[model samples]
Target: MPIPDDLHIQEAATLERKAFAAMESGHLAFRQGKISAMELFLLADKWELAEEALRCLEKTAQSS
Candidate 1:
């Protein structure tokens, strides 16, 4: 496989940061009761943040 250049690495990092932000937003929405379980999961899935989403879900469940 070809090695990624600086620009490619930076772009990937930016995308990951955006995904993390969206996942955090989804968790915030969940805590605020503004979104249902289905909506929260969908939001994470839509943003390609399943791991973060699952982390948020599990954290919430543990808190409750």
Candidate 2:
């Protein structure tokens, strides 16, 4: 039942990545004034994708 390292996300990795990307996008949306501060304040608490989302944000900020 062990999935090979190459087969990672054979279960939920795909969903996790998509979730992380989506949540990170929320931050950008808020930063660009697309979403209100109060909106992020409220929805941020509901986001469970912190670490990965931050990682994505860091990369994006670095690239720009």
Candidate 3:
């Protein structure tokens, strides 16, 4: 079984949006001193991973 292209694209877009939202929340938390620098760095890593995942999805779709 395989994921349909439309669904895959939608999933990728949703993940990317959530990743951006998480990054924004992390920034706000850091600015307000609610979170530490290390925590913010972790959130940044998450966003980077999301970006990489999106790129992989796009590449896979292109090949398909």
- Please report the candidate that would top lDDT against the real structure: 3
Which regions in candidate 1 have their CA more than 4 angstroms from the true location?
A: 1-4, 49-64
Off by over 4 Å in 3: none
Pairs that clash in candidate 3: none
Cα TM-score of candidate 1: 0.64
CA error at residue 23 for candidate 2, angstroms = 1.3
| lDDT of model 3, residue 39 | 100
- Rank list by TM-score: 3, 1, 2
Pairs in steric clash, model 1: none
lDDT of 2 by residue, 1-64 (tens): 6445433333245546666677788899998999998887756665665445545655544454
TM-score against native, each model: 0.64, 0.48, 0.90
- Cα lDDT for residue 53, candidate 2: 55
Summed over model 2, clashes come to 0
Per-residue accuracy of model 3 over 1-64 as CA lDDT, tens digit each: 8777887788789989999999999999999999999999999999999999998987777666
Separately for all candidates shown, the number of backbone clashes (residues 3 or more apart, or on different chains) is 0, 0, 0
Between candidates 1 and 2, the TM-score winner: 1
Best of the candidates, TM-score: 3
